[model samples]
Target: MYTLHYDSPLGGILLAADEAGLTGLWFEGEKYFANILGPEQQERETPALQRTKRWLDVYFSGREPDFTPPLHPVGSPFRRAVWELLLQIPYGQTTTYGALAQQLAAKQGKTRMSAQAVGGAVGHNEISIIIPCHRVVGTSGSLTGYAGGIEKKVRLLQLEHVDMSRFFVPTKGTAI
Candidate 1:
């Protein structure tokens, strides 16, 4: 295991990578990552990890980045689908967790997705803003569970130019 930390508007996030690719982006990294690393782990240079940080910088600046690097995502199939779908969420939009689950479910001819399940998956995303999980909101337009924190979610959405007026509107058709 190899690791390093970088600053983000959300705080310092720790990144880890192996030969497989960059594996995780952990918020409030120093304590979180330190606990998980095995003693044999060393700090190694990862161009992929570095590139991910650079892309995060672009995202914080409100410009979507073109991330073509290898991402070693660890999750169940449904979770992977949710994370990939997050990528399709154009930079300046928000979608409700139910809406996202419904959208994903439509691919398989069903309209059932548990907000709890999707929320759990989103919470564990190894990649954050670059993948845009921050775009997912409560069905009521409430900023809900974000591993990075709801305030960070608000900041990210604000940076993406999502109007503040929609911040807490929970109409039935409200997006994520």
Candidate 2:
């Protein structure tokens, strides 16, 4: 496995990858700091990592990046489904957890899916900005449950010009 460190407007970010693709991207000192890889790691700028850094550069500059770095976020089937939905969220748009659950329920042909379960998968997303997990909000348009920290989440939303006036830091459910 390989790792690369990127300094962004938000803070330092860690990127990880292997032969398959970009495996993980986590904020420094985040809730799940580099949880995707084992103990062994070598810090070097590989091709994939370079491409991801470029992508971040464009994204942080307040321009919609036209490309997405190759990602291989490791998770269960349910989590993978949730993450896939996250990618569909446009750069300047947000989606509610309950809405995602409804979509998943329809996809799976079930009566209903749990929003809490979707939140769990979103929280466990190893690839942060690239997978756009921060784009997920609560049913009431409250910014909730970002594993990278809500402050960072708010900054990301603001960076994307996501109309933060409609979203607020919730009084409950991991909004810090």
Candidate 3:
């Protein structure tokens, strides 16, 4: 595995990639920072890492990246499915966990799916911004459960031009 360090406007970010693509991106000191990396990781800038840096550059400049870098997030099949859905969230839009659960249920051909379960998968997303996990919110528009911290989540949404009036930081909740 190869890694690169980037100085983002919000904070320092550590990016990880391998032959396939970017495997992880985490804010310094954020929950689950580098959690997906194996012991054999090295600090070297690969093509994937460089491309990711460019993507971040566009993003931090307060504009949506016109392109997405290759991402190879590691997780279970269910988690991967959830991450795929996260990627579909529009650049400046937000969706609720319950809504995600309903979407997953329809995709899986089930009558119902648990919002808590969807939240669990969203919480464990290792790819962060590129996968757009920060776009997920609680049913009431509560900005909660971001492994990168709620403040960062809020900043990212603002960077994407999401209207902050619709979302609120929960005083008490998971990952608060």
Model 2: per-residue Cα lDDT at residue 102: 96
In candidate 1, what are the lDDT values of residues 1-176, reduced to their tens digit? 77878887768887777678777777773212334355776676678877877877887777867764577776689888888888788888888888787877787587687767777777667777666788888776677677666666778888888876856633332221
Model 1 segments more than 4 A misplaced: 29-40, 169-176
Please list the Cα RMSD from the true structure of every candidate, rounded to 1 decimal place: 4.4, 1.1, 0.8
* Model 2 TM-score, all chains together: 0.96
Superior by TM-score: candidate 2 or candidate 3:
3
Cα deviation of 22, candidate 2, in Å: 0.9
* Model 3 poorest 10 in a row by lDDT: 167-176
TM-score of each: 0.83, 0.96, 0.97
Give the per-residue lDDT of model 3 (tens digit) for 64-170.
89999998989999999999999999999999999999999999999999999999999999989999999999888899999989999999999998999978999
Better of 1 and 3 by lDDT: 3
The alpha-carbon deviation from the true structure for residue 130 of candidate 2, after best TM-score superposition, in angstroms, is 1.0
Q: Give the alpha-carbon lDDT of every model.
A: 0.72, 0.90, 0.92
**How does residue 172 of candidate 1 score in lDDT?**
35
* Whole-model lDDT, model 1: 0.72
**What digit string (tens of lDDT, one per residue) describes model 2 on residues 1-176?**
89999999999999999867799999998898888789888998888898899999999999999998888778999999999999999998899989999999999999999999999999999999989989999888888888889999999999998888878887765937
